[model samples]
Target: MQELKIERLVKRYPGRDQVIAVNHVDVEVQAGEMLVLLGPSGCGKTTLLRCVAGLEDAQEGRILLEGQPVFDASSGMNQPTHLRDIGMVFQNYSLWPHMTVQANVEYPLRARGAKADDRARRAAEVLEVVQCAHLSDRIPAMLSGGQQQRIALARALAPRPKVMLLDEPLSNLDALLRVELRAHLRAIHRELGFTGIYVTHDQIEAFNLGTRVAVMNAGRIEQLGSASQVYERPATEYVARFLGIRNSLAIDPQGGWHAGPTPLAGDLGRLDQHQGPMQLYVRPPSVSVLPADAPAPGPGQIVLSGARVKDVLYAGGEIDFVVELGQATLYATMRVGGAAPRASDPVRIQFASSDALLYRNGQLIDG
Candidate 1:
């Protein structure tokens, strides 16, 4: 089994002061694991991945692959990219237009002085592994976007690299193809058992492909956890908002939370210990909208009245009803085949305090 470890990793770009692309990052990826580096653009996820692949020189850090020191700034040792024995898939297909798919896939083997028969055998094996055997004879221009990307991936895997690094490999494809290739990548990773770091800004891709996710922000990891943990229990307000949780109201220092024009008569609980001015976040799915004729909820359930349906949008499997609760507008999703309120319709909303997440000083306080 292979393991990749990074300690106090830092990468910076030369600038007026210095632009830090990775800052004191400490993380590890166990064998057969896919560690996803997820963040919005300019968040330095790609830079961190590049530093690990030996493509970028880090100013400070130590990197270990399978207990071998590939990079150590203190020792003044840095291995070149090729010698690092890692595979990389770029955002673009990066295929040679003039070369056939077979030739492209075999390029790595040829570069390392492999004989023609050995290169042919390895290229054929990977092309078949990537399900591109039929397209192996075709030039890049002759194949579809998806096929070309598969060939690129085939090339990356042809050498049977121990560490695979993919930088938004599906970003260039259309939405449907992106999803298609995402599943393919997941399957390939599982079958090959290569420790990998996949970089992408798309949340769906991050959640779908990652064995564990490292949410990067301004060169630092804001949160590192499973998909469920990261999505349901974000470490910070930035992550909550980035995940599209919009039902956030300010909380005052006196353990009193401000929910627009609504009063906070409920128990403050853990939020009381926090300091001044925080944010309360809630997912739309956690908020239940009661029909006009429905009965009230049991004890401890927060029931807010005087809410009117501002808009109704059907979202395939669910209906999104925008409700004006006091001075704020909140959204709630209702499953199809249920009683859905339309525009101008009066509605009641209910949610438990446990579902409400609190954030003070940008970090999660209570949920």
Candidate 2:
């Protein structure tokens, strides 16, 4: 079993405009847990992973594996990459075109000075685990993107390193392959019980693959929590927006909601008291269609009485309603055959106030 910890890690690029690629980031991963680092393209997630893999130098900080320090800036002690006992899966498959799948997977064990029998056995075992045993004789150039990805994964796990670092390993695959391989990777993690840190810009990959996700922005970790907590109850305005929550209302201390060009009553419970400036978000799925005859206020319900259905869009399996609540336009996704209205039709929308997440400065304001 392996545990990894990063302390006050900082990586910067010195140029005309000096940029800090990775801020003072700190995180830890327990044995058998996959911690995912998620953010935009330039959010420093990749750099952080690279720093962990010893592929990038850090100006300051310490990294520990199983309580042993691999990097200690104060002591000027940085472990060489080959001695870190880490496995890396890159964005590109990075498989050798000339080598067979078996040979590629055997490279790690071979470099570690394992016997020919040990290398061959380890490579075959990992290839079978990744479901690419049948393709062991083929070269990467003859394989599909998904197959190549499997080969890369097998190669990384062949040596059974203490920790695995994956940097957008599935970003290059097609949509179908990405979905298929996500399940494959998760299952492999469960089977092998290896600690890992994954970096990706795709939300689905982050939420589905990670046991805990760390959302980063501008070289800093904005929020770190379970997938449900981060997605359902985002802590920051940046996180909410990044997660694609669209329903927003700016409210004053008096409970008046500035919902676009109009005003609505906002009952934020404790947050309504002495509020300076606060933003609230209601997830689209939480927004529901109200009956024509108004129902009594249910527990946690917040009703919008005079909303108009501006448009109804059909997208494959679900329908998206472009609802106009006064001057505010909000989107709600519902399954097929729901109580959908035509364009310009009068409609009502309701959602539980508890579902409305409050945030100020990209941080959750718990009531």
TM-score of each: 0.90, 0.91
Write one digit per residue (lDDT tens) for candidate 2, span 1-367.
4499999999999999988998999888999899999999899988898888888889999999999998888898889889998899998999999999989999988889999999999888998999989999999999999999999999999989989999999999989989999999999999998999999998999999999999999999989999998887787888888888888876555436455544443344545553677776887877876544555656656666677888888888878888887667888887846456777887777777778777777678852
lDDT of 1: 0.85
Predicted model with the maximum lDDT? 1
lDDT tens digits, residue span 230-250, model 1: 988999988888888888776
TM-score, cand. 1: 0.90
Error of 1 at 243 (Å): 1.7
Residue 342, model 2: Cα distance from true site in angstroms: 2.2
- Model 2 whole-model lDDT (C-alpha atoms): 0.84
Model 1 — which ten-residue stretch has the worst lDDT? 263-272
How does residue 90 of candidate 1 score in lDDT? 93
